[model samples]
Target chain A: MTGPGRPAAVTGIGLAVSGLGTPDDLLQPDGAEEAFDPATGLTGRAMRHKDRASRFALRAAADALRDAGLLTGATFAGPASRTCVVVSTNFGNLDSVCTFADTIAEDSVLGLSPLGLPHTSSNSVAGWLAIEYGLRGPNLTVCNGGTGGLDALFWARAMIAADRADVALVVGVEPDTAPVARLVGHRPRLDGAAAVVLESVPHRRSRGAPPRAVITACTHGAALPDAVRAVRGTDRQPVGLWLTPAGPRPGDAASSWCATTRDLTARLGECSGALGVLQCVAGVSYLDASGPGAVLATSADGPDHTAVAALLLTAPGQAS
Target chain B: MSCVITGMGAVAAVGGGPEQIFTALCAGTSGLTKLRAFDLNRYRAHHAYEIDDRTGPGRDEPLRATRWLVDAVEQACADGGLTPAARVPVLLGTTLREQRSVELWWRGEGEVSAADLHFGPALRRRFGFTRTYTFANACAATLYALGLATDLLDLGMADAVVVAGTDAITESAFGTLDRVQNRTPEALRPFDRARAGMLMGEGASAVVVRRDGDGDRPALARIRGVSMNCDAYHPTAPDPAGIAAAMHAAHTRAGLGPDEIDLVMLHGSGTELNDAAEATALHAVFGDAAARPLMTAIKSMTGHTLGGSGLLSLIVAVLSLHRGVVPPIAGLTDPADEAAGLRLVSGTAATAPLRTAQVDAFGFGGINAVAVVERS
Candidate 1:
C-alpha cells in the first residue's frame, strides 16, 4: 500500500472536450467556437452525433494529457512503459441506452444498430482510450454515480501503488441528454470531462519534471468526512476547493471554494458523467494561478450512489 | 505472495453448490433440458439448466440467481469459519444485472425498476459489507473480480475478500443471442471439428479469498497469480495472433513456466472461433508442453453462464486440486482438431495429482483473463 505521507504525483495528463478537441483549443478558448450555456454552466458547440458525455471526456482526456506534457511522443519514457486508463461514468451513455430501448420498441425483433449496442456500454470510453493509445494495462470503467470520477482516481492510485502501471490516466465523463435530464428530473446542463495522469513520487522526482500536485488521500461513500479527517488530521491550508453538485458550500473563512461546473450543469438538468473532470479542471486552473491545497468533491445521487473527495497537495515550494 | 482459496460455492445446471454439480459432472449427466423457466415459444433452442423456482428461505426464486450468489457467499464464509458479520470487502462480477428483469421490462411485462440496476447494492446490503464493488466485463468478469480481490489482499487492502459472480439467461438475452446467431440448440462440442456455436447457460459461483495464512485443510489450493489483457483486435472476435498476454502474466505471477502447468481449464464455450483461438493461445504458451497438460471444458454441463463462467471454472480447478481427478471434456468425441494439441481428457474422469492448473476466460469485448492455481 502507498504510505500515508508518501505522495502519488500527477506526472502526465490528457483531455479532449466539446468545441476544443485538443489542449491548445482548451487553453485558448477563444480559438474555438463559443461554447456557453445560459440555463446551465455548460458552454460548447452542439453536435448531433457527439453527445455531451463524449465531448466532455474527449476534451478532459486531451487537456489532462497536455497539462502533463504527455500528448507529444517526446514525453514518454519508452513505448513499453505500462500505462493504465480508468474512466468513470454515472449514467454511462444514457442517451444511447435509451435510444436502444426506443429502437427495440420500434422494431420488436428486427433492427438494432450494431454500433449503438457497444456504444451504450459503460466501458466504451475506456475501450476507446485503449484502442486510441494502445494502453494494454488494467483498463477499467467504474460507475458509482456522483463519486465515479473520484473513484476512478482512487483506483488509479491503487494501481500505481501496486506497481501495475507506471502512469495512470483517470478520466470522468457525464452526459446531458434529455433522457438523462428527465431521469434525474432536471434540465440539461453542460457535460464535462477531466483526466489526470498519476505516477509514483519517486518516478516524478527522478524524471526532473516540474513538481506537480500530490494526492495525499482520497475518501469515498457516506463516511468521507471521517476518512478525510483521518488522512488530513488537523492540517487545513486549502487555498481553493471544488464541491459536488449537492455538497454544502465551504464557509468563506477558507480560501477560494468555487462551485464546480457540475454544480452549474446539474442545475440545468445535465446528467453528464464528465462533470467531475470539469470540476477538476476548474480546480487545477485555480491552483495553477495562486491557489494551493485544493480539495475536490464530486457526488452523485442514484441507486448505486457514491461521493468522492480528493485532496491535492502541491509539493513544497511549488504551491502557487 | 501466494493467494489461497479458502472456500468456494457454486450453482450450476446440475444442482446447487459444488458437491452436487461435481457429482453430476462426474456422472456425465447433462443439465440440458427443455427451457421451462420462461416462455420461449418464438425461440429455436429451448433447453437450459433452469434452477427450481422456490422462494422464502428454501425456494430458488426466478430472481434466485442473485439470491443464490448471496447464499453462495454466505456458505463460503461459513465454510471458511468466518463470521457472517465480518467486514470483509467484496468483489462481484457479472455480464448483465438481472438480465431476466431487464427482459421482463423490455417485454412490457414489468416496470423498469431500481432492482434491475441496484443488483450490486442489493448484494452489498445482503452481505452487510461496507466495501463492495461490481464488475461487468462480459465472460471474464468473475476471473477479473477474483484477480482484483487477490491483488487488493496482496496489497493489504483487506484481510479477507469475497469474489463471486452470477448470471441468468433471460428470454430477451436469449432472443438477442438467437438474433446474433451465437447459440446452439443441442449440444456443446468444444474443439470438435463439427462444433457449432456456443450454448448459453445460466449459473453463479463464488470463492472466499484471503492472504496465505495458517490453514490445516488438506484440500486447500493457492492462487499464484492472475492476468487480464484486451485484444483490441475486434469487439467480438479474438486476435488471430493468439495473444498470450494473459497466459504470460499468469505464468510470471505464479512463478511457474508453461512447462510446469499440469492442467488447463479452458473457456471452451464450444464456439468454433473461441475454441480454436483458445487452442492457439494455449499452444503458444505451452509449446511442446501443450500436449502434456490435461485440458478440459466444463461448459458442456453448466452451459455458458456469461460472467459467472470464469469463477465456475476456477471452482472446478480447485476441486480438481482437491479430488486429484480431472473430468473429461464432455462432447468432444473424435480428435478432429489436432491444432488444440493439449491432452483432451475424454470418456471418463482421469485420477491424477494435479500440481498446478490454469483457467482461461475471454469476454465478448476483447477482454481476456487467466489465473493459475496450485495444490496447497
Candidate 2:
C-alpha cells in the first residue's frame, strides 16, 4: 500500500554471483570470479547435500538475513508465522534435474539417489532456505520467465500490504546449466543469485534498522508510456536510470535528467532470472548519492502484439 | 470482497466433468491401469493412474496435455458462461511441467520451447486469454494458483480468472516414484490398514472464478478463502504443524471458525507418510471436536494427480456441496487408528447438509495449502 510518501523500506541485501569478493565487486570491470563456488558460505552436511543452485541461493539468503540482522537474534521480535520467503526464477535447478533424469535413464529408477530427488523441484531452494532459517511462513516461487524478479518483489510487497507477513525475504537465483541457461540467452559466467529484505516503514523504524531506501512503486504492464509520470515535477527528480542490460537506452533528456545509466546486465553479466532484482539493488546504491531512482525492464512476449514491462520507483528514505 | 467458483472442469482417471467424475467415484471406479504413455521398463510399479494423453507434437494435437486442458477449459468456461473473447488470464499450476517436452530437451532433441514453459501464454495466443501464468510449486501448486487467482479477483485485477492445472505421467515421474519406493504394489488405499504407498496419478483440471459483484452469474460455490504455506522441515515430507497452521490461517482469513467446516478433501496420496501427516494435522486442528467434518480421500479412485490433485479435489468438493453427497473412498477397509473419531466414507457415498468444505493439498518440498468454500 505505497502512497505519495509511504513506501516499503529496504533494510538488507545479499548476493552470490559468478564473481568473487563482495557485492560492490559485481560493479567492477573484472568482477567475474575465476571460480566462485556456491558452497563457500554453507557448512557441514548441507554443503555436501545440496546442489550448486541450492548452495548459491543459501549463501545469498544467509548474507541477506545477516545484513538485516535477522540471522543473529531477530527471531525474538517476530513470530516465524509472520515471516515469509519468495523465490524468483525462470528455470529451476536444471542441472540437478538433468542429472536425475540421467540416473533414471541409465540405472533403474530404484537405483537412483533418493536424497537427490528433493532438489529436482523448482522451489527446492526456497524450501531449503526456509528449513535452514526457519521462516515458516508462506513459501512461493514466482517463475514468470525473465520478469520473475520484479514480480517476486511486487509479491513480497503485496504480502506485507495484505498483512500476510511482517517481514519478507525476496531472493532470485539463476544457476547456470549451459544448455538451459543458454535458452534464456545468459552467458556461462552469469551464474549468480541476489536477495533483498523488505519491511514496512514502521517495522523498520521500530527495529531501529537504518533504511537503505523506500520502494515507492512497482508495476508491470503489457506496455507503458514513453515517459513515466514518476519522473515528472521539479521536486520529484530522479537520481539515476537503471535498465536491464538487454533493455534499450533511455532518451538523452531522460538520461541527463538523472544520474548515469546503470546497466545491470553489463556489470553482473546477463542472467535472466537474477537481472531484475540486481538492477533494483544497483539502483538503490546509485541513488544513495543524490535522491530517488527509476528502473525499467521490458521483454518481448511474442511479436509486438504482446510485451511485458516492469517499472519500479524508489525514493530516499531520509528527508532532504 | 468474496470470490466465487463460477465454473469448473476436471479430466481425471474417472472421467471429465463433475457429474461424470462424481458418478464414477460413487460407483467405486478406479483409474489404475498400466503405464502406456512411455516405456516403463526402467522402473518398478507398472501401474499408474495415467491417461492416454497422446495428443501432441503433431497430428492436430500439438501437445500431449492440450486435449485434457481443452476439455477442462471448455467445460469450465461454458459452465461459468465465460468466453475467450473476454481476454481473461489463466493461472495454471502443475507439479511438473510437460514431462514429454522436458524429456526431449534432456535427450538433446530440443530445448525448453515457449510452448513447453507455460500454458498461460500459449493458451492466450490460441484461446484469446488476456494473460497466462504457470506455477511450478509441485503438488500443492494448483491450490497455490487458486490462492493467487482469488487475490487477483479480490483486488479487481481481473473480472474473471481461469485457474487451471495439468500434468501427465511420464518416464521421469514414474522413475521418481520407483526410486522413492512410495507406490503401492497392492492398491491405492488411504487410511486403511494396508495403506502401504501411493499410486502415481496424472490429469488436468480448470476452474473459472469471478469477483463477488460480477452480477448474479449463479456461482457453484463461494470461495471463502485460501491459505498456502511451507513446512520448512523436510523436502519431501510435510510437518503436521505446518498443515494445521495453513488450515487455521485459511479459517481465520475466511472469518470462519473451525466448527463451520462440515467436509474436507485430503491430499491423501495413498502413501503412509502423506496419510499419517494429514491425519496428525487434522487431529491438531479438530482435537476431537464433536462436529468434526467428515474427511474423505479421492485418490482411491483417481490415484494422486500430484499438483492436479488439489484442484480435482476442489471440483469434487464443489460438486459434493452442490449435490449434498460425499463421494466414497471407492475402496476402503480396515481403518487405521488415524481414522479414530473421524468419519471415513467407504463403499457408498454419504449424504449430508454440507454447507462448508475445504480442499487440502501438500507436495514435495514441504509445500502445503488449503482452500475453504461455502455453499452459495
Candidate 3:
C-alpha cells in the first residue's frame, strides 16, 4: 500500500445521458432532449428501452475511454494496460428486479422472461461492459448506496496500486426507475453516468499523453474534521459536494455543497446509480483557476457516515 | 502474499453449521428431500435441501436469508475472536437478495420495503458493520467476494475482513428456475452421463480473513490466487470452446502448471452443456493435469446455492485440508460419454493430502470465477 502522495490519475472520461444518448451528444446544448418519466418522477425524455443505468454507464464509459485516448489506440504502462471495470450503484435496476418478482407472483407456473432476469442482476452493467469491451480482467459491481461511485473509484485506484489491473474503468451510473423513486420519496433528477479511466502517473508521462486529473487522496469514514484538515493545507480551493436529503448546511457551501445521490435521484427520477456521474459533472463544471476542486461525496446511516473525498486536479494548461 | 482462512462457518440443508454438514458428508447421506419448506404443487421439481426456520437465530418470523448470513458472520467472528466494533470491512455475496420478500408479497402479507431489500445498508445494519460491500453477480458472487477480500487484506485496507454469502431458495426463485428449464426433477448428478439439470439449495457461509501476521491460525491454507472473468460471449450458455475468462483466471492466479493442482471443485450444474464446457476449460488449464486432479462435484450433495456456491465449495476445500480427505461425488453413476481421463471421485470419500485445489463458480450472464487454495 502506497502513501497518500501517490495519486490515482484520471486519464480518460466518458458519459451518456437521457438528453444526450451518445458521447458526442453529451453536453451539446440543443441536441439533447429533455429527459422525463412519470413513474420515476423524471421530467425529461429518458433513454429508450435501454435501462437508465446501462445507458448512463455506456455513455460515461465511452467518454472516459475516448478521453483517455484508449479508444484512439493509445496504451500506457502499469495497471492501465490491463484495464478493469468497477461500476457502483445505489439501486441496481430495482425496477427490473421488482418486475421479475411481480411476474413470479402473478403465475407460479408461467415462464419468466429470460431477458428480464439478466437485466435484474445488480452486476448486469458490469457484465455488459466486460462483454462490450472484451475486458476479461477484474470486473466488479459494488452497491453501497450513494457513496458507491467514490467507492468504485477508490477500488480502481487500489487495484492499480496492487498491480491487479493496469488501467481501470471506474463507472458510476444511476438511472431514474419507478421503484427507486418511491424508495427515496422523490423522482430521479438529472440521472447520469460518469467514467474515469485511472492509471499510474509514470505510465502516462512516459507515453507523452495529454495530462488529465490527478486524484490526490480518497478517504472514507464518518470523521470529516480529520479529512478536512488533511486537505486544508493544500494550495487548491477545494469545492465539496454533499448529496444528502437536507442538502449542505449554509456555511458548508463555502467549499462544500449538499450534492448527494438523494438530490440527484430526486431530480433524475429513477436514475439511482448514476448520481456519482452527475456529481463528477458538477465537479468538472466547477473547475477553474482555483485549481482542481476537491469533491467529497458522503452518505450516512444513523449516526455513522461514509465520506469519499477526492482532490481533483487537472493538468497544468488544461484547467478550464 | 498468502491469504489465510482464519475462520469458517456454513449453514446448509443437511445441517446448520460446518460440523453437521461434514458429518453428513462423511456418512454419505444425501440431503435431498421433498420440498416441504414451500408448497410445490404448481412445480414439478420439488426436491431441495431446505433450511428449517428454527435452525437460525430468529425463528418466530421467517427470517430473511440476510439474517442467516449475519448469524454465519457472527459465528465466524466469534470463531476468530473478533468483534464488530473492530471495524472489520465486510463483503457479502448473494445471487438472490431478499427474494423471500417476493413470496411474502405474493401471499398478500406485508411487502419487503426497498430499504430492507437493498443489500449494502441492510448488511451493515444486520451485523453492525460500518465499512461494508456487497456483490450480486449470479453464482460467482461469493467467490468474487473472496477474491475482493483477499485483495483488500493484501493491500492493507483493513487488518481483517469478513466475507459471507447466502441464498435461500424461495418459491419465487424456484419458479424462475423452473422457467429457465435448469431445475432437475429428481437429484443432482454432476458429470453423470444421464445427468439432466441442477437441484436448487439454500444456505449461508462466512469466512473471516486477516493478514498473515506473527500469530494467525498457522495459516491453514493460502488463497494463492483468484480470478473473475466474464464470458460476455453469451447470456446463458457458456462459450463452447470454454477457453475464455475462467481458464485465464485459473492459469493467471495459481501461476502453476495444471499438474500442480491436487483437486478440482466444479461449478457442475448437472447439465450436459455446463459440465462439458467445464471439462473443456479444465482440459485447457490443466492439459495433462485435467486428467490427473481428482475432480469432484459437491453440488450433487449440497445442491446449488448460487451466490453462496463458490464460497461453500471453497469451505469444502478448506475442510479437505483439515481432514485430509476428499469427499466423494454423491450421485455420479455414469461419467459423461465424452469424459476424458478425468478422475471423478464417486461412491466413497477418498483420503489424500490435498495441497492445492481449484474451485469454480460460473453464473448466468457469462460471469466465471475461479479460486486457488493451498495448504500453507
lDDT per residue for candidate 2 within B1-376, as digits (tens), equals 9899998888987787778988888778888887664446776777778775554522112245655776788888888888875347677787666654666576675555633555645675567663566677788989988988887766556788898888765455556666786544546888887776777776789998998768456888999999988888888877888999998888887888878888989787777777788888887887756237877889888988877789999999988887889988855778887777777888788888899998899987787889999888
Candidate 3 lDDT, tens digit per residue, B39-142?
46566687876676644342213345777787778777777666775257788887766656634543454455544554556656655665666667678889
Order of all candidates by TM-score, from best down to worst? Answer: 2, 3, 1
Error of 3 at B326 (Å): 1.5
Q: What does DockQ come to for candidate 2? A: 0.43
Chain A TM-score of each candidate structure, as shown = 0.74, 0.84, 0.73
Error of 3 at A81 (Å): 8.7
**Candidate 1: tens digits of C-alpha lDDT, residues A1-320:** 21224457765455444433332233342445544332333344422234456555655565566666666652333232267777777555556555554555456423554444344344556665555556667766665445456656667777777777767778877655655555554644445566877766666666566645666666444344444444454564443455446453344632333432225343323434455555555444444555545555444434444323444434334421
Worst 10 residues of 2 chain B by lDDT: B55-64
* Better structure of 2 and 3 per lDDT: 2
Flag the better candidate by DockQ, 1 or 2. 2
Docking class of 2: acceptable
Residues A1-320 of candidate 3 have per-residue lDDT tens digits of 11234566666666655554433333234444444222343222322444667666765676677777777442222332166778877555666655655665555546476445556556777876666666756777876555566667667777777666767888877665665565566733545676777776666676665555555555544444544444443563444443333333224434342232224434334443454545454444333223233544433322234332322333324321
Candidate 2 per-residue lDDT, tens place, A1-320, comes to 11223367777788877655556555555645454555454455656678776777877777777887777653323456778888877665666656666777787686677777676566787888788777777788766665667767777776676666778888888776754654555454367788888887778778787777666665544433322333232355454554544544455656565565556666555465566676666555555544445544333243232434354546544631
Ranking by DockQ: 2, 3, 1
Cα TM-score per model: 0.84, 0.90, 0.85
Looking at model 1, residue B323 earns an lDDT score of 88
